[model samples]
Target: MTDKRTTAPALLCDVMIQIKQRLRPLESQEVLWDQAAGRVLAQAITAPVSLPSFPRAAMDGFAVRSSDLEAASPEQPCQLQVRGVAYPARPWPGTVSVGTAVRIMTGAAIPEGADTVAMLEDSEVSADGQFVSFRRPSPPGRHVIAVGEDVRAGQVVLPAGRVLRPQDVALLVALGLTSCPVVRQPRVMLLVSGSELVPPGVIPKVGEIVDSNTPLLQALIPRDGGQVVEVLRVPDDPVLLRQAFRQALTKDIDVVLVSGGSSTGDEDFCPCVLAEMGELVAQGLAIRPAAPTGFGWLNRAGTLLPVVLLPGNPVACLVAYELLAGRIIRHLAGRSLDLPHCQRTAPLRESWSSPPGRLEWVRVCIEQNQAVPLRQRGASSISSLVAADGFFLVPEEVTLYPAGTIVTVYLFDTLSGQQF
Candidate 1:
């Protein structure tokens, strides 16, 4: 029996909306503070105690009463006795009196009755080591870090749904938290099917080639916050493909990725298998280089798992994964569904043309503040992606971009050698 399917491709925006409506972030779990980086916070964190919970010296100076130095200047320096010294974790035993100053180091606690700190450079110590003189008067609270200056108690330092950074881990450690509650990473199962494909390090016969999609997806899955739990290689045979799909669904996984057999060729069986086993929400996309991408929901016991079908062509597989599968994985991992790239506006170096009614992603390299389109633009050309620095999209209604037109380029990596 022939499988019936929709001929018209679904709009990219509409398919994304459907995915957002169906997928929710996974449950939360506790992880050590060191492992919390790059994980989304599932709960808000409040400061239990204020940062720098004590009044401390901001620099190496003497703590003094502001009134003692108010009328003192270079001509008439104020002479005060040096009572004691204060070091980090060691506070002066006595308070600062009306005519005495305490020698303090940076980050040391200020003594009681002292409201100002005079820098060592601006003060002179007597040869007898019994007295210190201030040449300039300092105002009250000068060079002093007051209580709760950096963060106050009961303040929310981190909120839910926030993706933690390396600096964030430091903040949590400073807050005295050993562990943090974060959304669990999504688990993924990959099924790569192609009879003409061979594994890496294997010599293929005349009609076969190495399977690149499996390794590509394996690397990409974790980069997008999902963990690859299993990988299954299936041939073009329908029974084996169905068995692999069934086996993947039975395992504990949040999403399934089928890397080949998504197009309309005679050997293409992903769309048909998915339709027979579950509901195919979208069979094709109205986007260039990845129009054969498909999305669906599979029922595992009582849970519905999201599954994506990526094209067999290397470039198309990458495009479809970044635009569709990546978003789904990020959503389940409690991360933003937006594209993970830095965008910059630049003028086109040459005129570019595209067919109307389909959105196209054009790869280009930034040259002297201009977006220069690459020459290798085929779906199977993986070298184009490597040679290009970034890409810009042409909207469905627009057909042509004239030379020197300002366009936004989404960088594959950051412009300043930083990762987004």
Candidate 2:
């Protein structure tokens, strides 16, 4: 009978500040370097040994003294005795003398007394394998990788808080690291509360819809470096919702996400339950499509678990998750707090308008390097997101963006399908 919506909605910036102030990264754990990709580094990794610790050939070449080829030319080719051959794992035991050369493969240790490597293409070896002839002068250090050419011992190769990529894993392996210290992934519990919702496999009857939020969150949680430990579908009843909240807190959860029941409707009980169980820090964000978004802290044992109350609408739920829940999860996983989107400044293909006081996320398709605003702007339009390549935010103060206005579009697919 009473409207409980806050007349003055909290700014998105304020809510984000509160969330960051209360949460911290999870404890670090040691995992094998082979399994460290996509995990955030918990500590700085210093190189124990220099990469290419020994002087090695950078290409398949003949290791020879630079002075021997100093006067070699097309008209007066230089001839040198072939001392031995060197492979990557097998180095030539003998040294390169003034008139001799060692046939060396890439990555093979450079034979002693050799200051340059004449590429195999530039040298001709005799059929008898006794002598090699070069027509071009070779410079010192040419085609040779000196000791510590790539990484130096005791140098910080990977810094703390960095998400390990495939290349990063390779570097760690090159550094001779068997295991790496990475922040543990944040554990999450998803609670989808609605009476008219059915599981994904079930065919929804009249007035009932398939619960898409669960699957959406399931996919997104891991993308933001979170592990969903439990998922529960709660009815609209406040009692059951409250029980679900209690049960989620009992588990080892870093964050609890409640999709639906966040608005100020009669069945909307998430805000009340949060207030009763812990402290409701934010409610009714000043953001379009996700205005009912709420944030709170639940005291479980001695820890304060973050609880995000997202609107039931599929699009609204997604927006809230991207702006709030995703940030929380990434922070707890020791990753950057920035949104996992590659942003690019592009001009709008058409004019767009938003409410003067609410931040709006406008789904747009990139066409001809321009952001084309979609027609489906409803909070429940999942199709809009499906068709969108990215979205752009309109500031709370601005109401309209004229056609061709430059705006930053956050791309959904970039940097391995996420943030840059």
Candidate 3:
């Protein structure tokens, strides 16, 4: 028999911990290094060979032995014969014996006997290219980079579980890696339920609303490393919703996101359907504007698959996704448990009030070091989310705050136009 539940709201922090403990990471896969950006590293990466591999010049200067010019003065320039010119990545092919110097460019290998380099401004090359004079003396090892200076072979470069950034991919390529091992992206199946909902690009008739949740979840799921494999729309009928859940259980899906129909109203069938198919882990959360958020698990072929029921309101759905569904998606992608966001601290432009029972998240915009609260037209307002730069959380312990209150704003635009 499936375990069913309808109980008191769960504390925000406890539910976060529970979600972390319940999920397991997916298997790793091999992908090309160029395609590994935004993916989690499955194994620690080590340098295959030391960078530079040999000693080279770091500046466009004449290679010389320091002792030859130690006693030489600017007025009495140290005169030396220029044996040969060394271009980048090429050596002079001969040693700089006493009173001799090699004209070298940046990144050129040092001659066998040269121990230092003098800048071009300090040396005057003769028109014949056979002689050069130094006005300044250079110490040994100046402007010279030794072998293994940047990275050493067999040394760990990046640890496992690191989210690959653009620079990380460049580093891996520089280390001669053509491919990388990363955790597989989780596949999601989205099911939207509502009798009044219509797809985008279609004008809704009277008493009907455009289906925003489907497109919203489609854009967000992949940003967090989960790919939406399918999207299906179902009416408010329990029979159709039950059939959708049964069909989803038979397919290969990492998680099922059921949007709408999670409330206690008569049309809400997500909780009842989840209870019949599997175990309802929790019914609600003690959070403002998102109290209808819930999650559960369904068993198929002896494997437990997670099912997340989301509220219909766009803003509430966004909050529920970030705090709950996003966590599981990141875990399945082998990412770190910490939720990442670009944070900015600012003072409130006006006073704000909240209830004491549930945690609250307020959308706000930053203007000249102040967080101006956006006008909330209920949780269904998509314009408010777009106009706001980020949001601030209000704990259940605090109810009111005066103007100029400093708060940290968690930015949602960190990964805009880029894969996370």
* Shift in Å, residue 363, candidate 2: 1.6
Which ranges of candidate 2 are over 4 A from the true structure? 1-7, 69-78, 121-124, 415-420
Candidate 3 residue spans exceeding 4 A from truth: 1-6, 375-377, 415-420
Spell out the clash pairs found in candidate 3.
none
Better of 2 and 3 by lDDT: 2
Candidate 2 local lDDT, 49-132, one digit each (tens): 998889999899899999999999878889999988999999999878889999999999999999999988788889999999
Superposed by TM-score, candidate 1 places the C-alpha of residue 321 at a distance from the truth, in angstroms, of 0.7
TM-score computed on alpha carbons, candidate 2:
0.93
Across 1-420, the per-residue lDDT of candidate 1 in tens digits comes to 157476799998998898788778999999998799989999999988898788999999999999999988899999999999999889997989999999999999999999989999889999998999999898999999998898898999999999999998998888788899999999999888899999988999999988888888888888789999988889998889889878977798999999998987788888988988898888899888899999998998878899999999998999899889999999999999988888899999899999889889888998888899996778998889888888998999999999999999999875457332
For residues 55-150, what per-residue lDDT tens digits would candidate 3 score against the true structure? 789999988999998876789999999888898756778889999998889999988899998889888888988888888789999999988898
lDDT of 2 at 117: 95
lDDT of 3 at 342: 77
Q: Looking at model 3, which ten-residue stretch has the lowest summed lDDT?
A: 1-10
Look at candidate 3 and tell me the lDDT of residue 336.
63
